[model samples]
Target: MNKTILSLTGAVLFATGAVVAQTMAQSTSESTVAPQEADAASVARGAKAWTNHCSRCHNLRSPSELNAELWDVSVQHMRVRANLPGAVADDIKAFLMSSATSTGVQYSTPGQGGASVASFAHLSPGDPLHGKEIYSQTCIACHGADGKGTISGVPDLTAAKGRLTKTDEVVLTNIIKGYQSEGSLMAMPPMGGNPDLTEQDIADVLAYLRKEYDIAPGTE
Candidate 1:
């Protein structure tokens, strides 16, 4: 009798969670792709892409954040704002819809454990335009407005995207932690020498770099 009661209770909890997730999905503003277009392989690719690309700027957003339609709108906005290619945008949509509210199952975006770039809260809610302004004031002196940097000591912000190995979480430490250039005598002050810069300012700067430089999450 106890075992049966426990089983029933577990089922009840799972059912409740599913229902709440579904309701959130329905109410969300993200636009949804057609159900038929969603497939396992594409979803997997999207997960990988999300980890590499999206996670750079933000955490793995819960799938329930938006309904199908809202996901469509959100993805479309990112495509233009972040310059996602046609096929990739489609894959991400399919993945988000499929995972949004599956009954009796849970999903987290895959391949998040070994972040290639450092991560931080500053980059999580980065605003691209606002980031551009911050970058102009703080980062431009070293990284250059075009992101080419000083070539010898400073890293080229534009090119780092192609070779980025650190996760955003890990990369945040790089920004927040700061670094001394190896064998090059150039030293970057922790927090870019400005204690007043908020995490949002950092986030915005990272966002601007990703958008303006077209930094796709590297395979690394």
Candidate 2:
């Protein structure tokens, strides 16, 4: 009777140990797979969000130009600019950082013999006149009619000397990526919240600003 009792206890212990090991293996697999799945989903959602909301305000550029810290600031500001819901905005930020500058390496833009000339010449021209109308409807409140900002601390569009001198690529990239100016409470919002605008619309607006404001494009 004593021997039978001991054998029963040993079998139970062995079974329990096997079950625990299986459980641990399963848990480890899930832990590894979950992050990869989440990352993929985040990228897909971010790409959609970029097309619908961001492409209107800016063009796609290499992610390497901005550091993760810069991207963090820019993404937060864009949340307000695009009027994105909290969850969606978070996803977009995650997506951009993962693909663009997560490695902290600087990226180069196309053309200009590797000089990193930023330009929207890749996109078609939009109607500058229509862009002006769009600007009036959405952007004028902050950027003003002349593209000069009326609010204190807003960038002066009429005198965007440094910005315009940046390659058309840089200007377009800024419009798309968005950024926080030093010592300013407000960041430039994406597309100024005009979801109807397309890539061409942004291109057109830049053209209008360059011509009307005499903002010269940068040379490589």
Candidate 3:
């Protein structure tokens, strides 16, 4: 395991109390809707621009990875880091927030550039309600409704949470690109076999898993 990645991701999970409180306080129903309106052309234009510019530096994480406010912070920080123009950066930020519209459970993790939210800042306690839907769509086939595996070599989630030493980062990163466990023939396929799963979708599913299994928060 990469120690740096582990420590960084761990810190975000540990610091959620403050961010969540702040977000809920600031995000009133009226206040949220006004700033959240997306430009008619922002999504399409930003998506194209993101692929063209941002992908050059890092893996193209789905827009849902960071919340809009986090995205705003990241884009501004990156604008300076990457020397991006104001107009172009705004478009990129637009694309991100459109795809991953905030559900008000705001959590900020460390950024990719330094200790701020940037290219890699992700982890929302996530919406367990929405996560349940994603779980049914993607993970139900193999993991089942109760989180018990239906096949050989598959670990049951109820018990698997206790078995793994490194929970959140290890599991999440694997979901993105896929990986083989330390001693298993059954390699976890990328996106858990759902090719269309976005990073945000995966985050939701993880939130469900963490809640259902009582995994993430105090595990480490």
Please name the candidate that would achieve the greatest lDDT relative to the true structure.
Answer: 3
Candidate 2 residue pairs in clash (backbone atoms < 3 Å): 58-176, 118-168, 118-169, 118-170, 119-168, 119-169
lDDT of 2 by residue, 108-212 (tens): 333434324345667876566876755655456556676666555567876656556766776665555444454655444444333345667777778777777
Residue range 85-201, candidate 1, lDDT tens digits:
967887777656554442312122113542133435333577889989877765664566677863345666666543234445444445554544335444343455344566667
- Root-mean-square deviation of every model: 18.9, 14.0, 21.4
Per-residue lDDT of model 3, residues 1-220, tens digit only? 6999999888887778668877776665557567643463554455456656775687655455677689888888888988888777877777666545423211322122222222325556567788798777556644667877644455677774342324455556655555445455444445654445677777777787788788654333
Q: Estimate each model's TM-score.
A: 0.41, 0.44, 0.42
Question: Which sections of candidate 2 miss by over 4 Å?
Answer: 1-121, 160-162
Please report, as a residue range, the 10-residue window in candidate 1 with the lowest summed lDDT. Answer: 102-111
lDDT for model 3 comes to: 0.60
State residue 59's C-alpha deviation in candidate 1, in Å.
39
1 against 3, candidate with superior lDDT: 3
The full ranking of all candidates by lDDT, starting with the best, is 3, 2, 1
